[model samples]
Target: MNYSHTTLTGDEGPQQQVTMFLTRHTKTTANAIDLIQGWSDFPLTQEGIEIARQFGRGLQGTRFAAAYCGTLTRHYETARIALDNSGNDNVEIRFEPGLREYNFGSFEGRDVSTTHQAVAEWLGYSTVEEARAARGPKFDLDVQDALYALDAENMLHTDLVPQDRAESADMVKQRMWQAMTNIGDLVSREGGGNVLVISSGTAIRQFLWTIDSEVDLTYLGNTAVTKVDYDKGTFSIEQPVGSMAYYERGAQ
Candidate 1:
């Protein structure tokens, strides 16, 4: 919710504007196997395809000004599917490098159960379960949360030029915030309007966490939408995680 007050010629007065929709790319094959997928570029599962399509159908009547997608195939492909299904094929899907998922480095494509142990040890926790529990009772083998936990401490290897090491949580937020700021600048300079941002759940969760520590991210399901408004100077979460209810499909 970015805002600035300005006078109108008539009595209409100033109004707030600037809107963006953030959504997680649907499930991938890695998800089925309980593997951690960070920058691995796994293709979407069949279920993932349907999830994106349903979201698109739900958005069929809505029109977007433009779209921003990560360089990965799943990210861009999800955006494409939604845009096409939403009947907005004319909107350009820009390749946004900043929107890519966290670079998990050595942990990419590894089993979460195993990596949790490794990360826990790396972070000096007795066990990954202990570290996961430290975050809160609800947090499980969530790879995103685990990474954020490590990054919260000084354990992660950041400040590297090439960033071959695991990307810090702060870095992920910076990247997403940059993407939002760029879009916000575009909208502000060119007249504000709605924009679609296709990203991953882990990344989106980190962005939300960066903004508000009280945000509850436990039940955020596939293709869930988080509405945010932004200006060049600030980005605001209009709707927090799991704000949009998914289209119902039974017994899949």
Candidate 2:
């Protein structure tokens, strides 16, 4: 596909635009079991592998100038499978720790219901359902804030778990923004072209939230692609967040 765009500047004539394909990693064992993965590393499920293959097949004709992924097994595994199936195996996948998911500290590997229950209490909601209804699109981000508060207070601390280990919403947003900006800068320096980036669900959402908080944050399915355009120094979402068209196309 022709992912490049050109814009006329007052005196600069035309400028090249770089396209960023930000994708969420496929389902993992933790996800399959309804666990809060956080910074934990989990292998992709068999179904996840197949879906990633479909994501690649859907973009069979597209070429990327660069590829990047978080320094997690799930992240790299998804990127590898998609690139291999898409015939872009030749592109080197760069690992960036800044792209990793939010650290949930003691909450890691816990049941989602359990975590949400605690978060609801921390946020002063009578129940998780109440919290969800009250916060609506911001509920997910509120969960992050509640987790950070719980961690900071040592509410769930054990000998192995330490206080203040979880990342606050601000921290996640800062790091994700920096990581994405750096990638954009690097690709733009290389003459601006299409780029592929694989990251976790929450991390990807946090990054997009930084760009536009009004974006829908209800859910982001596995292997869903969120297209963004980079030109000069600005980033803009190309479509609604978390479009599963690629996966659906590949399924056909």
Candidate 3:
């Protein structure tokens, strides 16, 4: 849970496996400030922008052979800031929808701080924040639990992720696995190197789950880095979920 200013060394084995550096985006207005954000594009807050810059600085001299991100602005901006600051500023950032977050459905722009009791009444939660909280610390660690939670509220969206249904945790895992597998293959074919990925928390959680299903996918900090090793078409977690010096400059 304590993420220091560190990088995962990809020298763990022979040339068969590729090491990928996957990181959640720094705080968005929803994450660090206000408004519920799920698949919604919100620019990074002022503090978030600075944190991302620091995120880049934390890497210092580290190099990413290639970089990728989701189509959302938050994902791209975060990657731009961090990748550019990594001292290897020339890495072209690629956009891929496979790294996008779970669609929040009807809950996209709701105010998390107040006025959602009516909406939560049938959603199995007493407030909007309660439903939102279902993501991280409050997640039951069971895919069924996530399904139940999403089902309670996502019905309001006529065209939700699964057609009037909220996206299941297993669905997230599937998409993330495919995305990572594709990237891992590219890395292996091109020899091997660190591939930077800037994505959202929910997608990243599923990626981590693929590495270690027993791990509780929670507490992933803003800009936290999770490293995975892809070897001979197999993937393993190198670093599950860890942080850096985003809060305090000298901490990491």
Give the candidate number with the greatest TM-score: 2
Candidate 1: residue 89 Cα off by (Å): 1.7
Among all windows of ten consecutive residues in candidate 3, which has the lowest summed lDDT?
Answer: 1-10
TM-scores, one per candidate: 0.78, 0.91, 0.76
Candidate lDDT (C-alpha), each: 0.70, 0.83, 0.68
Q: What lDDT would candidate 2 get against the real structure? A: 0.83
In the range 1-252, model 2's lDDT, one tens digit per residue, is: 122222222343344688989999998999899999878898899998898999999878899888888888888889888999888989988887788899998788889998899899888898999988988868888888888888878777554444437888899999888888877776776667998898888888888888887888868899888998988779899877899998888878
| Candidate 1 C-alpha error for residue 119, in Å | 2.5
Please estimate how well model 3 matches the true structure, expressed as its whole-model Cα lDDT. Answer: 0.68
Clashing pairs in 2: none
- Candidate 1 wrongly placed segments (more than 4 Å): 1-16, 121-129, 137-162, 244-246, 249-252
Tell me how far candidate 2 lies from the true structure as C-alpha RMSD in angstroms.
5.7
Q: Write the per-residue lDDT of candidate 3 for residues 1-252, one digit (tens) a residue.
A: 121212224543445567777888988878765565667888888988888888888787678888888878888888888877778689887777778877655556666453244434444676656755764443423433344365565544445554534466676778778888777766666667888888887678767876776765666788888788888778777643555543345236
Per-residue lDDT of 145 in model 3 = 37
What does candidate 1's lDDT look like per residue over 1-252, in tens digits?
A: 111222123323333356778888877898889887878889899988887888888787677887877788888878888898888889978777777888876556878787777666765688866876675623432455456555444354555333555676677888877776766666555556778888877677777766777777665676778888876557778755665553342112
The 10-residue segment of model 2 with minimum total lDDT is 1-10
Rank ordering of all candidates by lDDT, starting from the highest: 2, 1, 3
